[model samples]
Target: MGSSNTSFRQGFILVGFSDFPHWSSFFSVLISVFYSLTLFGNSAIIILSQLDARLQTPMYFFLCYLSFLDLCYTTNIVPQLLINLQGHDRTISYGGCVAQLFLFLALGSTESVLLVVMAFDRYVAVCRPLHYTTIMHPLLCLSLAIASWVGGFNNPLFQTSLMMVMPLCGYQLNHFFCEMPILLKFTCEDTGGTEAKMFVARVVILVFPVTLILGSYTNVAQAMLKTKSMAGCKKALGTCGSHFVVVSNFYGAAIYTYLQPQGSYSESKGKFVSLFYTIITPMLNPLIYTLRNKDVKRAVWKVLGRGTDSG
Candidate 1:
Protein backbone atom coordinates (compact mmCIF):
# COMPACT_ATOMS: atom_id res chain seq x y z
CA MET A 1 0.00 0.00 0.00
CA GLY A 2 2.86 2.41 0.79
CA SER A 3 4.57 1.52 -2.48
CA SER A 4 1.33 1.99 -4.42
CA ASN A 5 0.71 5.39 -2.86
CA THR A 6 4.30 6.45 -3.59
CA SER A 7 3.95 5.37 -7.21
CA PHE A 8 0.68 7.28 -7.51
CA ARG A 9 2.38 10.41 -6.21
CA GLN A 10 5.31 9.93 -8.60
CA GLY A 11 3.02 10.14 -11.65
CA PHE A 12 3.44 8.70 -15.17
CA ILE A 13 5.22 10.08 -18.19
CA LEU A 14 2.95 10.30 -21.23
CA VAL A 15 5.25 9.40 -24.14
CA GLY A 16 2.75 10.84 -26.57
CA PHE A 17 4.06 11.30 -30.12
CA SER A 18 7.65 11.78 -29.06
CA ASP A 19 8.93 9.21 -31.52
CA PHE A 20 7.88 11.34 -34.48
CA PRO A 21 9.64 14.48 -33.28
CA HIS A 22 9.33 16.17 -36.64
CA TRP A 23 5.56 15.75 -36.72
CA SER A 24 4.89 17.25 -33.30
CA SER A 25 4.12 20.67 -34.74
CA PHE A 26 1.85 19.13 -37.38
CA PHE A 27 -0.09 17.09 -34.84
CA SER A 28 -0.35 20.08 -32.51
CA VAL A 29 -1.87 22.21 -35.25
CA LEU A 30 -4.22 19.41 -36.33
CA ILE A 31 -5.45 18.71 -32.80
CA SER A 32 -5.98 22.42 -32.08
CA VAL A 33 -8.08 22.87 -35.23
CA PHE A 34 -10.18 19.77 -34.50
CA TYR A 35 -10.72 20.73 -30.87
CA SER A 36 -11.82 24.24 -31.84
CA LEU A 37 -14.25 22.83 -34.40
CA THR A 38 -15.60 20.35 -31.87
CA LEU A 39 -16.26 23.18 -29.44
CA PHE A 40 -17.96 25.35 -32.02
CA GLY A 41 -20.01 22.66 -33.77
CA ASN A 42 -21.33 20.92 -30.64
CA SER A 43 -22.11 24.23 -28.91
CA ALA A 44 -24.14 25.25 -31.96
CA ILE A 45 -26.19 22.08 -31.72
CA ILE A 46 -26.93 22.61 -28.04
CA ILE A 47 -27.84 26.27 -28.47
CA LEU A 48 -29.95 25.67 -31.58
CA SER A 49 -31.79 22.78 -29.97
CA GLN A 50 -32.68 24.91 -26.95
CA LEU A 51 -33.49 28.20 -28.67
CA ASP A 52 -35.52 26.93 -31.61
CA ALA A 53 -39.03 25.70 -30.75
CA ARG A 54 -39.06 23.40 -33.78
CA LEU A 55 -35.86 21.74 -32.58
CA GLN A 56 -37.35 20.60 -29.27
CA THR A 57 -38.52 17.14 -30.30
CA PRO A 58 -37.26 13.85 -28.82
CA MET A 59 -34.65 13.54 -31.57
CA TYR A 60 -33.23 17.03 -31.00
CA PHE A 61 -33.38 16.63 -27.24
CA PHE A 62 -31.25 13.50 -27.58
CA LEU A 63 -29.00 15.34 -30.01
CA CYS A 64 -28.48 18.09 -27.48
CA TYR A 65 -27.29 15.46 -25.01
CA LEU A 66 -24.95 14.00 -27.63
CA SER A 67 -23.46 17.41 -28.44
CA PHE A 68 -22.85 18.08 -24.77
CA LEU A 69 -21.23 14.67 -24.40
CA ASP A 70 -18.98 15.29 -27.38
CA LEU A 71 -17.97 18.65 -25.98
CA CYS A 72 -17.02 17.10 -22.64
CA TYR A 73 -15.45 14.05 -24.25
CA THR A 74 -13.09 16.08 -26.38
CA THR A 75 -12.36 18.69 -23.74
CA ASN A 76 -11.24 16.04 -21.23
CA ILE A 77 -8.30 14.82 -23.35
CA VAL A 78 -7.56 17.31 -26.09
CA PRO A 79 -6.13 20.07 -23.90
CA GLN A 80 -3.75 17.71 -22.14
CA LEU A 81 -2.82 16.19 -25.49
CA LEU A 82 -2.06 19.58 -27.01
CA ILE A 83 0.11 20.54 -24.05
CA ASN A 84 2.08 17.29 -24.33
CA LEU A 85 2.47 17.70 -28.06
CA GLN A 86 3.73 21.26 -27.80
CA GLY A 87 5.74 21.17 -24.55
CA HIS A 88 8.76 19.13 -23.50
CA ASP A 89 7.31 17.83 -20.23
CA ARG A 90 4.73 15.16 -21.08
CA THR A 91 3.59 13.85 -17.72
CA ILE A 92 0.13 13.54 -16.20
CA SER A 93 -0.39 13.26 -12.43
CA TYR A 94 -1.93 10.04 -11.12
CA GLY A 95 -5.11 11.81 -10.09
CA GLY A 96 -5.42 13.51 -13.50
CA CYS A 97 -4.89 10.23 -15.33
CA VAL A 98 -7.51 8.48 -13.23
CA ALA A 99 -10.01 11.28 -13.72
CA GLN A 100 -9.33 11.27 -17.48
CA LEU A 101 -9.83 7.52 -17.67
CA PHE A 102 -13.08 7.70 -15.71
CA LEU A 103 -14.55 10.62 -17.67
CA PHE A 104 -13.45 9.20 -21.03
CA LEU A 105 -14.98 5.83 -20.33
CA ALA A 106 -18.17 7.27 -18.88
CA LEU A 107 -18.74 9.73 -21.71
CA GLY A 108 -17.94 7.07 -24.30
CA SER A 109 -20.25 4.46 -22.77
CA THR A 110 -23.02 7.03 -22.43
CA GLU A 111 -22.75 7.75 -26.16
CA SER A 112 -23.07 4.06 -27.07
CA VAL A 113 -26.29 3.73 -25.05
CA LEU A 114 -27.51 7.13 -26.21
CA LEU A 115 -27.07 6.14 -29.85
CA VAL A 116 -29.36 3.16 -29.25
CA VAL A 117 -31.89 5.44 -27.60
CA MET A 118 -31.71 7.75 -30.63
CA ALA A 119 -32.15 4.78 -32.95
CA PHE A 120 -35.19 3.69 -30.97
CA ASP A 121 -36.58 7.20 -31.31
CA ARG A 122 -36.15 6.96 -35.08
CA TYR A 123 -37.71 3.49 -35.07
CA VAL A 124 -40.79 4.71 -33.24
CA ALA A 125 -41.20 7.77 -35.44
CA VAL A 126 -41.03 5.70 -38.59
CA CYS A 127 -42.76 2.45 -37.57
CA ARG A 128 -45.41 3.92 -35.26
CA PRO A 129 -45.88 7.50 -36.36
CA LEU A 130 -49.33 7.89 -34.80
CA HIS A 131 -48.01 6.77 -31.40
CA TYR A 132 -44.63 8.55 -31.62
CA THR A 133 -45.70 11.50 -29.48
CA THR A 134 -47.21 9.37 -26.73
CA ILE A 135 -44.36 6.87 -26.85
CA MET A 136 -41.58 9.45 -26.79
CA HIS A 137 -43.27 11.90 -24.49
CA PRO A 138 -41.22 14.55 -22.63
CA LEU A 139 -41.10 12.46 -19.46
CA LEU A 140 -39.94 9.35 -21.32
CA CYS A 141 -37.34 11.35 -23.25
CA LEU A 142 -36.01 12.86 -20.04
CA SER A 143 -35.93 9.44 -18.37
CA LEU A 144 -34.07 7.82 -21.26
CA ALA A 145 -31.57 10.69 -21.32
CA ILE A 146 -30.95 10.32 -17.60
CA ALA A 147 -30.66 6.56 -17.96
CA SER A 148 -27.99 6.90 -20.63
CA TRP A 149 -25.98 9.19 -18.37
CA VAL A 150 -26.37 6.92 -15.33
CA GLY A 151 -25.37 3.78 -17.23
CA GLY A 152 -22.40 5.53 -18.78
CA PHE A 153 -21.02 6.86 -15.49
CA ASN A 154 -21.59 3.57 -13.60
CA ASN A 155 -19.52 1.31 -15.91
CA PRO A 156 -16.44 3.49 -15.49
CA LEU A 157 -16.48 3.19 -11.70
CA PHE A 158 -15.88 -0.57 -11.85
CA GLN A 159 -13.30 -0.28 -14.65
CA THR A 160 -11.35 2.57 -13.08
CA SER A 161 -11.32 0.92 -9.65
CA LEU A 162 -9.94 -2.28 -11.14
CA MET A 163 -7.27 -0.33 -13.04
CA MET A 164 -6.03 1.86 -10.15
CA VAL A 165 -5.35 -1.06 -7.81
CA MET A 166 -3.04 -2.91 -10.20
CA PRO A 167 0.72 -2.70 -9.41
CA LEU A 168 2.49 -1.02 -12.27
CA CYS A 169 6.02 -1.97 -13.37
CA GLY A 170 6.79 1.37 -14.91
CA TYR A 171 5.45 4.92 -15.35
CA GLN A 172 6.03 5.56 -19.04
CA LEU A 173 2.66 5.37 -20.80
CA ASN A 174 3.29 4.97 -24.54
CA HIS A 175 0.13 6.72 -25.73
CA PHE A 176 -1.37 10.20 -25.68
CA PHE A 177 -3.87 9.51 -22.85
CA CYS A 178 -4.60 7.17 -19.94
CA GLU A 179 -6.47 4.42 -21.81
CA MET A 180 -7.15 0.92 -20.40
CA PRO A 181 -5.26 -1.34 -22.80
CA ILE A 182 -2.17 0.86 -22.79
CA LEU A 183 -2.18 1.16 -19.01
CA LEU A 184 -2.54 -2.63 -18.68
CA LYS A 185 0.78 -2.99 -20.44
CA PHE A 186 2.58 -1.57 -17.38
CA THR A 187 1.05 -3.95 -14.79
CA CYS A 188 3.59 -6.04 -12.82
CA GLU A 189 1.36 -9.09 -12.38
CA ASP A 190 -0.04 -11.44 -14.99
CA THR A 191 -3.25 -9.68 -15.97
CA GLY A 192 -4.92 -12.41 -18.01
CA GLY A 193 -7.94 -12.57 -15.68
CA THR A 194 -8.14 -8.79 -15.42
CA GLU A 195 -7.96 -8.49 -19.18
CA ALA A 196 -10.70 -11.06 -19.58
CA LYS A 197 -12.93 -9.20 -17.14
CA MET A 198 -12.31 -5.93 -18.97
CA PHE A 199 -13.05 -7.66 -22.26
CA VAL A 200 -16.43 -8.71 -20.92
CA ALA A 201 -17.11 -5.16 -19.73
CA ARG A 202 -16.12 -3.76 -23.13
CA VAL A 203 -18.52 -6.14 -24.86
CA VAL A 204 -21.29 -5.07 -22.56
CA ILE A 205 -20.56 -1.40 -23.14
CA LEU A 206 -19.66 -1.48 -26.84
CA VAL A 207 -21.08 -4.59 -28.50
CA PHE A 208 -24.41 -4.77 -26.68
CA PRO A 209 -25.40 -1.22 -27.55
CA VAL A 210 -24.35 -1.79 -31.17
CA THR A 211 -26.61 -4.83 -31.37
CA LEU A 212 -29.54 -2.78 -30.07
CA ILE A 213 -28.91 0.03 -32.54
CA LEU A 214 -28.75 -2.41 -35.44
CA GLY A 215 -31.95 -4.13 -34.37
CA SER A 216 -33.72 -0.80 -34.07
CA TYR A 217 -32.57 0.23 -37.53
CA THR A 218 -33.61 -3.10 -39.01
CA ASN A 219 -37.15 -2.50 -37.81
CA VAL A 220 -36.97 1.03 -39.10
CA ALA A 221 -35.94 -0.22 -42.57
CA GLN A 222 -38.88 -2.64 -42.70
CA ALA A 223 -41.34 0.12 -41.85
CA MET A 224 -39.80 2.41 -44.46
CA LEU A 225 -40.30 -0.32 -47.10
CA LYS A 226 -44.04 -0.46 -46.45
CA THR A 227 -44.62 3.28 -46.63
CA LYS A 228 -46.19 4.51 -49.90
CA SER A 229 -45.64 8.25 -49.70
CA MET A 230 -42.39 9.34 -51.37
CA ALA A 231 -42.21 12.52 -49.31
CA GLY A 232 -42.58 10.58 -46.10
CA CYS A 233 -39.97 8.08 -47.22
CA LYS A 234 -37.56 10.86 -48.14
CA LYS A 235 -38.07 12.64 -44.82
CA ALA A 236 -37.54 9.41 -42.88
CA LEU A 237 -34.43 8.62 -44.90
CA GLY A 238 -32.96 12.07 -44.31
CA THR A 239 -33.39 11.89 -40.55
CA CYS A 240 -32.46 8.21 -40.15
CA GLY A 241 -29.62 8.36 -42.64
CA SER A 242 -27.85 11.17 -40.76
CA HIS A 243 -28.08 9.15 -37.56
CA PHE A 244 -26.80 5.99 -39.27
CA VAL A 245 -23.84 7.91 -40.66
CA VAL A 246 -22.96 9.23 -37.21
CA VAL A 247 -23.34 5.70 -35.81
CA SER A 248 -21.08 4.24 -38.45
CA ASN A 249 -18.36 6.80 -37.79
CA PHE A 250 -18.50 6.42 -34.00
CA TYR A 251 -18.96 2.64 -33.69
CA GLY A 252 -16.58 1.72 -36.46
CA ALA A 253 -13.67 3.47 -34.75
CA ALA A 254 -14.66 2.31 -31.26
CA ILE A 255 -15.12 -1.37 -32.18
CA TYR A 256 -11.78 -1.39 -33.94
CA THR A 257 -10.07 0.00 -30.83
CA TYR A 258 -11.78 -1.84 -27.92
CA LEU A 259 -12.90 -5.16 -29.45
CA GLN A 260 -9.42 -6.38 -30.41
CA PRO A 261 -6.95 -8.40 -28.34
CA GLN A 262 -4.36 -6.42 -26.36
CA GLY A 263 -1.42 -8.46 -27.63
CA SER A 264 -2.17 -7.29 -31.17
CA TYR A 265 -2.46 -3.62 -30.15
CA SER A 266 0.11 -1.21 -31.53
CA GLU A 267 0.67 1.99 -29.62
CA SER A 268 1.16 3.97 -32.83
CA LYS A 269 -2.06 2.67 -34.33
CA GLY A 270 -3.92 2.98 -31.06
CA LYS A 271 -2.97 6.66 -30.72
CA PHE A 272 -4.29 7.43 -34.19
CA VAL A 273 -7.48 5.46 -33.59
CA SER A 274 -7.98 7.30 -30.31
CA LEU A 275 -7.57 10.54 -32.19
CA PHE A 276 -10.30 9.44 -34.62
CA TYR A 277 -13.03 8.78 -32.06
CA THR A 278 -11.80 11.36 -29.59
CA ILE A 279 -11.01 14.32 -31.79
CA ILE A 280 -12.08 13.77 -35.39
CA THR A 281 -15.46 12.16 -34.80
CA PRO A 282 -16.66 14.80 -32.34
CA MET A 283 -15.69 17.49 -34.81
CA LEU A 284 -17.62 15.71 -37.55
CA ASN A 285 -20.84 14.91 -35.64
CA PRO A 286 -22.49 18.34 -35.75
CA LEU A 287 -21.54 18.65 -39.39
CA ILE A 288 -23.04 15.24 -40.10
CA TYR A 289 -26.35 16.07 -38.37
CA THR A 290 -26.75 19.69 -39.48
CA LEU A 291 -25.86 19.16 -43.13
CA ARG A 292 -28.81 16.85 -43.72
CA ASN A 293 -31.13 18.50 -41.22
CA LYS A 294 -33.43 21.07 -42.77
CA ASP A 295 -34.79 22.11 -39.41
CA VAL A 296 -31.34 23.05 -38.09
CA LYS A 297 -30.61 24.98 -41.26
CA ARG A 298 -33.83 26.93 -40.93
CA ALA A 299 -33.04 27.59 -37.29
CA VAL A 300 -29.59 28.83 -38.25
CA TRP A 301 -31.08 31.10 -40.87
CA LYS A 302 -33.75 32.34 -38.48
CA VAL A 303 -31.15 33.25 -35.86
CA LEU A 304 -28.95 34.83 -38.50
CA GLY A 305 -31.88 36.81 -39.92
CA ARG A 306 -32.75 38.11 -36.48
CA GLY A 307 -29.13 39.15 -35.94
CA THR A 308 -29.07 40.82 -39.33
CA ASP A 309 -32.26 42.79 -38.63
CA SER A 310 -31.00 43.89 -35.19
CA GLY A 311 -27.66 44.94 -36.64
Candidate 2:
Protein backbone atom coordinates (compact mmCIF):
# COMPACT_ATOMS: atom_id res chain seq x y z
CA MET A 1 0.00 0.00 0.00
CA GLY A 2 1.07 3.57 -0.64
CA SER A 3 1.73 6.19 2.04
CA SER A 4 -1.35 8.02 3.23
CA ASN A 5 -2.36 10.82 0.93
CA THR A 6 -3.87 12.86 3.77
CA SER A 7 -1.37 15.17 5.37
CA PHE A 8 -0.86 15.02 9.10
CA ARG A 9 -1.83 18.67 9.18
CA GLN A 10 -1.52 19.10 12.93
CA GLY A 11 1.81 20.01 14.50
CA PHE A 12 3.08 18.15 17.57
CA ILE A 13 3.90 19.92 20.84
CA LEU A 14 7.32 18.84 22.05
CA VAL A 15 6.84 18.88 25.86
CA GLY A 16 10.62 19.15 26.16
CA PHE A 17 12.06 19.40 29.65
CA SER A 18 8.67 20.54 30.88
CA ASP A 19 8.68 18.14 33.76
CA PHE A 20 11.72 19.84 35.20
CA PRO A 21 10.72 23.43 34.94
CA HIS A 22 13.62 24.41 37.14
CA TRP A 23 16.27 23.17 34.71
CA SER A 24 14.77 24.78 31.64
CA SER A 25 17.12 27.76 31.60
CA PHE A 26 20.07 25.63 32.60
CA PHE A 27 19.64 23.13 29.77
CA SER A 28 18.90 25.87 27.30
CA VAL A 29 22.22 27.54 27.96
CA LEU A 30 24.15 24.29 28.29
CA ILE A 31 22.78 22.86 25.05
CA SER A 32 23.46 26.11 23.24
CA VAL A 33 27.10 25.97 24.31
CA PHE A 34 27.36 22.32 23.38
CA TYR A 35 25.86 22.97 19.97
CA SER A 36 28.32 25.77 19.24
CA LEU A 37 31.27 23.64 20.28
CA THR A 38 30.03 20.76 18.18
CA LEU A 39 29.78 22.94 15.08
CA PHE A 40 33.13 24.62 15.50
CA GLY A 41 35.07 21.49 16.39
CA ASN A 42 33.67 19.26 13.64
CA SER A 43 33.98 21.96 11.02
CA ALA A 44 37.59 22.61 11.98
CA ILE A 45 38.39 18.92 11.53
CA ILE A 46 36.77 18.78 8.10
CA ILE A 47 38.29 22.03 6.85
CA LEU A 48 41.76 21.26 8.15
CA SER A 49 41.68 17.77 6.64
CA GLN A 50 40.66 19.18 3.29
CA LEU A 51 43.11 22.08 3.17
CA ASP A 52 46.22 20.31 4.43
CA ALA A 53 47.75 17.91 1.91
CA ARG A 54 49.64 16.31 4.77
CA LEU A 55 46.35 15.10 6.26
CA GLN A 56 45.48 13.33 2.99
CA THR A 57 45.78 9.81 4.31
CA PRO A 58 43.40 6.93 5.00
CA MET A 59 42.96 7.60 8.72
CA TYR A 60 42.35 11.33 8.33
CA PHE A 61 40.12 10.56 5.36
CA PHE A 62 37.82 8.61 7.66
CA LEU A 63 38.17 11.33 10.28
CA CYS A 64 37.06 13.95 7.77
CA TYR A 65 33.97 11.92 6.98
CA LEU A 66 33.30 11.45 10.67
CA SER A 67 33.54 15.18 11.27
CA PHE A 68 31.21 15.92 8.38
CA LEU A 69 28.71 13.36 9.66
CA ASP A 70 28.80 14.86 13.13
CA LEU A 71 28.23 18.33 11.72
CA CYS A 72 25.14 17.22 9.81
CA TYR A 73 23.98 14.95 12.60
CA THR A 74 23.83 17.70 15.21
CA THR A 75 22.40 20.30 12.85
CA ASN A 76 19.43 18.02 12.21
CA ILE A 77 18.27 18.16 15.84
CA VAL A 78 19.82 21.00 17.84
CA PRO A 79 18.18 24.04 16.28
CA GLN A 80 14.72 22.75 17.02
CA LEU A 81 15.81 21.66 20.46
CA LEU A 82 17.23 25.10 21.21
CA ILE A 83 14.01 26.72 20.08
CA ASN A 84 11.96 24.47 22.29
CA LEU A 85 14.24 25.16 25.20
CA GLN A 86 13.71 28.93 25.13
CA GLY A 87 10.37 29.75 23.48
CA HIS A 88 6.81 29.85 24.66
CA ASP A 89 5.83 27.58 21.77
CA ARG A 90 7.31 24.13 21.80
CA THR A 91 5.64 22.64 18.72
CA ILE A 92 7.10 20.98 15.66
CA SER A 93 5.30 20.68 12.36
CA TYR A 94 4.32 17.20 11.18
CA GLY A 95 6.65 17.53 8.22
CA GLY A 96 9.47 18.78 10.39
CA CYS A 97 9.09 15.90 12.82
CA VAL A 98 9.24 13.32 10.06
CA ALA A 99 12.29 14.97 8.55
CA GLN A 100 14.08 14.95 11.89
CA LEU A 101 13.21 11.33 12.52
CA PHE A 102 14.40 10.19 9.11
CA LEU A 103 17.58 12.24 9.00
CA PHE A 104 18.54 11.51 12.57
CA LEU A 105 18.09 7.80 12.11
CA ALA A 106 20.01 7.83 8.87
CA LEU A 107 22.88 9.93 10.16
CA GLY A 108 23.13 8.06 13.44
CA SER A 109 23.16 4.75 11.62
CA THR A 110 25.78 6.07 9.24
CA GLU A 111 27.99 7.21 12.10
CA SER A 112 27.73 3.77 13.69
CA VAL A 113 28.80 2.10 10.47
CA LEU A 114 31.42 4.75 9.76
CA LEU A 115 33.03 4.11 13.09
CA VAL A 116 33.34 0.47 12.10
CA VAL A 117 34.89 1.47 8.81
CA MET A 118 37.30 3.66 10.75
CA ALA A 119 38.17 0.74 12.94
CA PHE A 120 38.99 -1.21 9.81
CA ASP A 121 41.17 1.67 8.64
CA ARG A 122 43.00 1.56 11.93
CA TYR A 123 43.27 -2.22 11.67
CA VAL A 124 44.92 -1.99 8.29
CA ALA A 125 47.13 0.88 9.39
CA VAL A 126 48.35 -0.87 12.52
CA CYS A 127 48.03 -4.60 11.91
CA ARG A 128 48.92 -4.49 8.24
CA PRO A 129 51.15 -1.42 8.25
CA LEU A 130 53.29 -2.32 5.22
CA HIS A 131 50.22 -2.82 3.03
CA TYR A 132 48.15 0.03 4.46
CA THR A 133 48.61 2.50 1.62
CA THR A 134 48.21 -0.09 -1.14
CA ILE A 135 45.14 -1.62 0.53
CA MET A 136 43.30 1.60 1.45
CA HIS A 137 43.91 3.31 -1.84
CA PRO A 138 41.80 6.19 -3.10
CA LEU A 139 39.21 4.06 -4.90
CA LEU A 140 38.70 1.72 -1.94
CA CYS A 141 38.52 4.61 0.52
CA LEU A 142 35.97 6.41 -1.64
CA SER A 143 33.98 3.20 -2.03
CA LEU A 144 33.89 2.57 1.72
CA ALA A 145 32.90 6.19 2.37
CA ILE A 146 30.14 6.00 -0.21
CA ALA A 147 28.93 2.67 1.15
CA SER A 148 28.69 4.05 4.66
CA TRP A 149 26.52 6.95 3.48
CA VAL A 150 24.35 4.87 1.11
CA GLY A 151 23.80 2.21 3.73
CA GLY A 152 23.09 4.87 6.33
CA PHE A 153 20.50 6.81 4.34
CA ASN A 154 18.81 3.84 2.66
CA ASN A 155 18.12 1.68 5.70
CA PRO A 156 15.98 4.27 7.47
CA LEU A 157 14.05 5.46 4.42
CA PHE A 158 11.41 2.71 4.27
CA GLN A 159 10.98 2.34 8.00
CA THR A 160 10.63 6.06 8.62
CA SER A 161 8.13 6.46 5.79
CA LEU A 162 5.93 3.69 7.14
CA MET A 163 6.24 5.01 10.65
CA MET A 164 5.19 8.49 9.64
CA VAL A 165 1.96 7.17 8.14
CA MET A 166 0.66 5.53 11.29
CA PRO A 167 -2.63 6.92 12.61
CA LEU A 168 -2.03 8.82 15.80
CA CYS A 169 -4.25 9.36 18.83
CA GLY A 170 -2.99 12.92 19.22
CA TYR A 171 -0.08 15.14 18.27
CA GLN A 172 1.31 15.81 21.75
CA LEU A 173 4.52 13.75 21.93
CA ASN A 174 5.38 12.61 25.47
CA HIS A 175 9.01 13.54 25.14
CA PHE A 176 11.12 15.92 23.15
CA PHE A 177 11.54 15.40 19.42
CA CYS A 178 10.39 12.38 17.36
CA GLU A 179 12.11 9.20 18.40
CA MET A 180 10.41 5.99 17.26
CA PRO A 181 9.92 4.28 20.61
CA ILE A 182 8.66 7.42 22.28
CA LEU A 183 6.41 8.24 19.37
CA LEU A 184 5.02 4.72 19.57
CA LYS A 185 3.07 5.88 22.61
CA PHE A 186 0.92 8.17 20.47
CA THR A 187 -0.05 5.34 18.11
CA CYS A 188 -3.75 4.52 18.08
CA GLU A 189 -3.23 0.75 17.69
CA ASP A 190 -1.44 -2.01 19.57
CA THR A 191 2.25 -1.58 18.67
CA GLY A 192 3.54 -4.84 20.13
CA GLY A 193 4.37 -6.46 16.82
CA THR A 194 5.61 -3.22 15.38
CA GLU A 195 7.73 -2.65 18.44
CA ALA A 196 9.18 -6.12 18.13
CA LYS A 197 10.03 -5.52 14.49
CA MET A 198 11.60 -2.17 15.33
CA PHE A 199 13.66 -3.75 18.08
CA VAL A 200 14.92 -6.35 15.65
CA ALA A 201 15.78 -3.72 13.07
CA ARG A 202 17.55 -1.61 15.67
CA VAL A 203 19.63 -4.62 16.65
CA VAL A 204 20.65 -5.21 13.07
CA ILE A 205 21.57 -1.56 12.56
CA LEU A 206 23.54 -1.24 15.78
CA VAL A 207 24.86 -4.70 16.59
CA PHE A 208 26.33 -5.55 13.22
CA PRO A 209 28.51 -2.45 13.03
CA VAL A 210 29.47 -2.61 16.70
CA THR A 211 30.48 -6.24 16.37
CA LEU A 212 32.72 -5.36 13.44
CA ILE A 213 34.29 -2.49 15.40
CA LEU A 214 35.09 -4.80 18.29
CA GLY A 215 36.55 -7.43 15.99
CA SER A 216 38.75 -4.94 14.23
CA TYR A 217 40.01 -3.57 17.53
CA THR A 218 40.68 -7.06 18.86
CA ASN A 219 42.87 -7.88 15.91
CA VAL A 220 44.56 -4.52 16.29
CA ALA A 221 45.35 -5.33 19.90
CA GLN A 222 46.84 -8.72 19.08
CA ALA A 223 48.91 -7.28 16.27
CA MET A 224 50.22 -4.53 18.54
CA LEU A 225 51.25 -7.11 21.14
CA LYS A 226 53.32 -9.03 18.56
CA THR A 227 55.19 -5.87 17.56
CA LYS A 228 58.41 -5.00 19.47
CA SER A 229 58.48 -1.20 19.03
CA MET A 230 56.95 0.76 21.86
CA ALA A 231 56.36 3.61 19.40
CA GLY A 232 54.24 1.44 17.09
CA CYS A 233 52.15 0.19 20.01
CA LYS A 234 51.74 3.72 21.30
CA LYS A 235 50.69 5.02 17.92
CA ALA A 236 48.21 2.17 17.48
CA LEU A 237 46.61 2.86 20.84
CA GLY A 238 46.48 6.58 20.15
CA THR A 239 44.71 6.00 16.84
CA CYS A 240 41.99 3.75 18.26
CA GLY A 241 41.47 5.41 21.64
CA SER A 242 39.46 8.43 20.45
CA HIS A 243 37.16 6.22 18.41
CA PHE A 244 36.71 3.86 21.34
CA VAL A 245 35.64 6.74 23.56
CA VAL A 246 33.16 7.94 20.96
CA VAL A 247 31.79 4.43 20.44
CA SER A 248 31.22 3.83 24.12
CA ASN A 249 29.46 7.16 24.60
CA PHE A 250 27.29 6.80 21.52
CA TYR A 251 26.47 3.09 21.72
CA GLY A 252 25.89 3.04 25.44
CA ALA A 253 23.24 5.73 25.14
CA ALA A 254 21.73 4.31 21.96
CA ILE A 255 21.51 0.75 23.23
CA TYR A 256 19.77 1.87 26.38
CA THR A 257 17.51 4.20 24.42
CA TYR A 258 16.42 1.68 21.78
CA LEU A 259 16.95 -1.82 23.13
CA GLN A 260 15.62 -1.54 26.65
CA PRO A 261 12.01 -2.75 26.58
CA GLN A 262 9.49 0.02 26.02
CA GLY A 263 7.91 1.74 29.07
CA SER A 264 10.76 0.66 31.32
CA TYR A 265 12.75 3.74 30.34
CA SER A 266 12.50 6.78 32.56
CA GLU A 267 11.64 9.81 30.50
CA SER A 268 13.82 12.06 32.61
CA LYS A 269 16.73 9.64 32.49
CA GLY A 270 16.18 9.17 28.81
CA LYS A 271 16.31 12.93 28.33
CA PHE A 272 19.68 13.11 30.03
CA VAL A 273 21.00 10.18 28.02
CA SER A 274 19.66 11.67 24.81
CA LEU A 275 21.38 14.96 25.61
CA PHE A 276 24.68 13.21 26.16
CA TYR A 277 24.34 11.09 23.05
CA THR A 278 23.19 13.81 20.71
CA ILE A 279 25.03 16.83 22.05
CA ILE A 280 27.87 15.91 24.37
CA THR A 281 29.33 13.08 22.31
CA PRO A 282 29.69 15.16 19.16
CA MET A 283 31.24 17.98 21.15
CA LEU A 284 33.80 15.72 22.80
CA ASN A 285 34.98 13.96 19.64
CA PRO A 286 37.32 16.65 18.34
CA LEU A 287 38.54 17.44 21.83
CA ILE A 288 39.44 13.80 22.33
CA TYR A 289 41.31 13.60 19.03
CA THR A 290 43.05 16.92 19.53
CA LEU A 291 44.31 16.12 22.99
CA ARG A 292 45.28 12.54 22.21
CA ASN A 293 46.47 12.86 18.61
CA LYS A 294 49.80 14.53 17.87
CA ASP A 295 49.30 14.21 14.13
CA VAL A 296 46.04 16.12 14.14
CA LYS A 297 47.52 18.85 16.35
CA ARG A 298 50.57 19.19 14.09
CA ALA A 299 48.34 19.20 11.03
CA VAL A 300 46.29 22.00 12.55
CA TRP A 301 49.50 23.98 13.14
CA LYS A 302 50.77 23.22 9.66
CA VAL A 303 47.55 24.48 8.13
CA LEU A 304 47.63 27.63 10.26
CA GLY A 305 51.32 28.34 9.54
CA ARG A 306 50.95 27.88 5.77
CA GLY A 307 53.32 24.96 5.13
CA THR A 308 55.48 24.30 8.18
CA ASP A 309 55.29 20.54 7.76
CA SER A 310 55.87 18.69 11.05
CA GLY A 311 57.27 15.59 9.40
- Cα lDDT of model 1 by residue, 1-311, tens digit: 33544447688899899889999999999889899999999999999888888888999999999999999999999988998998667988899889999999999999999999999999999989899999999999999999999999888888898998888766789899999889887777787888888888889998998899999988988878888889988988987998999999999988898889888988899998998999999999999999867788888887877432222
| For model 1, the run of ten residues with the poorest summed lDDT | 302-311
TM-scores of the candidates are: 0.95, 0.93
lDDT of each: 0.89, 0.82
Output the number of the lDDT-best candidate.
Answer: 1
Q: In candidate 2, which residue ranges exceed 4 Å CA deviation?
A: 1-7
lDDT of 2 by residue, 272-295 (tens): 788787888999988987786766
Error of 1 at 170 (Å): 0.8
